[model samples]
Target: MIPETLLIEYNATLKTFDKDEIIFSEGEFARNYYQVKHGIIKMNNFNDDAKEFIQGIFYKRQSFGEPPLFIDVKYPANATAIEKSTIYILPKEKFYKLLQNNKEVHFKITESLAKRLYYKAIIASEISSQEPSHRILRFFDYLKNDVFKQEGKFTLKINYTRQQISDILGLRVETVIRTIKQLEKQGEVKIENRKVYR
Candidate 1:
């Protein structure tokens, strides 16, 4: 269902992208915020070695592009669709003005930014304090607890591969594989092909 508020204060724009499509590149003008009505979007950055590191992945009912637009800065990471996607575009100025007039909108934006910062701090803490396998396990634990629940032995969603998961967790693919195998051995998780079990 579309938000009536969005319809009144914003404009819906349909955008289509194929799998692995770059929706917006790093350093692009963040003139609008996007709402994902369907499909998935992954935000990634290139490391010093030029390997794309997945920072975050979002699915249906989620939104992105807010921080850069609100801060009046270029995007810090690239946004790519993991599959075919459709997004609703909300122009920054209109959105900002609406927020300025609506205390509820203002509070909601502030709350979202605070939650994002908290997640970033958690990621930094995990990188500093945990070993590779532990970090990957912790990452999966987080996904299970927050993103999806266990269904039998596997997670409900299969959004990432070992390599992409490793990149996001700052671990090597080999380490990710080893960690998952260990989980499977412990009956904590199972893996078939590249699908995850929990």
Candidate 2:
């Protein structure tokens, strides 16, 4: 992600959003680059039956909705503030200028986008073919290993709620709950005081 000072130097503005506020809607023209300053943002889409599918969840210092800025396209999903959040917003033109002037920052952006693409591909495959338990395990492993960068068998507490995990994995909340309990019984995860750990 771009540094705060650099974002400010490029005329980026910090704005606050209330929980569940829609930052941008699907099909809107991409006009700005958003970096989370505090709290969380989720990019999602709803199907015909009104089922929500989470495309991605971004945390502090993480940037979202940049691919459309790089390519001339409308946003594919709606970005919403999942919690009361503050975000740094940089106009697309200034964002392009900043990247052009800063090669290192540009490379970092490319690397981040590539990793997201890899995650999308893996998750898509899991949803299509894997069992619920397998999908959940793979998703948790990705969070612990890739996102959090934790190694070995260290206990990593899950940051997402069961409902969030269900939305992300295309499963029902009951399925996620049952799977987690099953995983616990199978000695795959530890549930301590209602918090899940791996």
Candidate 3:
């Protein structure tokens, strides 16, 4: 993600939304670059049956909905506030200009987009070819190493709830619950105080 200082210096404005508020809907023109100042935002899609699938979650300081801005297209999915949140918004033209002027920031954005693409490819393979436990572990391991970046020999706290994990992994919540217990039994993960640890 780009630095907050850069966002501010580029004349980014702050916007706030309540929980469950839609920041932008699918098919809307991606006119602004958004960075989370506080709370969480989720990018999601719905199937014909109305089942929601989470594309990704953005935590504090993380940016969301960038591919459209770069590719000159509408948003492919909806972004919603998971809680009361503040976001820094940079107009699309200004955002493009800033990236043009900042080579390092552009490289960083490229790396981020590359990582997202890798995750999508891996998840797609998991969904098509792997078992439930393998899919869950692959996601947990990726989250630990890439997102959380944990290293020491201790329990790592996870931010996503089981239901959220299920949604993200395209599995049922019941399957997630059962799989988690199986993982605990295998000492792959721990369930302590009703919280998950990797």
Candidate 4:
């Protein structure tokens, strides 16, 4: 992510969003680069029947909705604030200029985007062919290993809610609840005081 000073130097603006506020809609032309300054943001889409599919969740210092800015395309999903959040917004033209002037930052952004692409591919396969339990465990593993860079058998607390897991994994909330309970019974996960740990 671009540093706050650099973002400000490039005329980026910091804006606040209330929970559930739509930052941008699907199919809108990409005009800005957004990096979270505080709280959470989720990119998502709804099917015809109004079932929501979350594409990705981003946290502080993480950037989202960049691929469209790199390529000339409309946004494929809607970005919404999951909590009252502050975000740094740099205009697309200034974003391009900043990247051109800062090679190291540009490489980091490219690496981040590549990782996201890999995650999407893996999730697509899991959603298509894996069982609910397998999908859920893989997701937990992904967070621990890939995102958090944790190693070995160390216990890692899962921060996502059951409903959020269901949304991310394309499962019903009931299914997620049942699977977590099953995982606990099978000694695959620990449920302590209603919190899940793996």
Indicate which candidate wins on TM-score. 3
Query: On residues 129-158, what C-alpha lDDT tens digit does candidate 1 reach at each position?
Result: 998767776777667765554645465555
Give the per-residue lDDT of model 3 (tens digit) for 38-133.
999999999999988999999888899999997889999999999999999999999999999999999998998898899999999998899889
Off by over 4 Å in 4: 152-155
Please tell me which predicted candidate would have the highest lDDT against the true structure: 2
lDDT of 4 by residue, 3-100 (tens): 99999999999999999999999999999999999999999999999988899888899999999998889999999999999999999999999999
Ranking by lDDT: 2, 4, 3, 1
Residue 121 alpha-carbon offset, candidate 4, angstroms: 0.5
Q: Against the unseen true structure, what C-alpha lDDT does each candidate score?
A: 0.76, 0.94, 0.92, 0.93
lDDT of model 4 at position 197:
88
Model 2, TM vs. native: 0.96
2 against 4, candidate with superior TM-score: 2
lDDT tens per residue, model 2, 1-198: 899999999999999999999999999999999999999999999999999999999999999999999888999999999999999999999999999999999999999999899999999999999999999999989888878887765378897899999999999999999999999999888998888887
Cα miss at 136, model 1 (Å)? 1.7
Model 4 is weakest, by summed lDDT over 10 consecutive residues, at 146-155
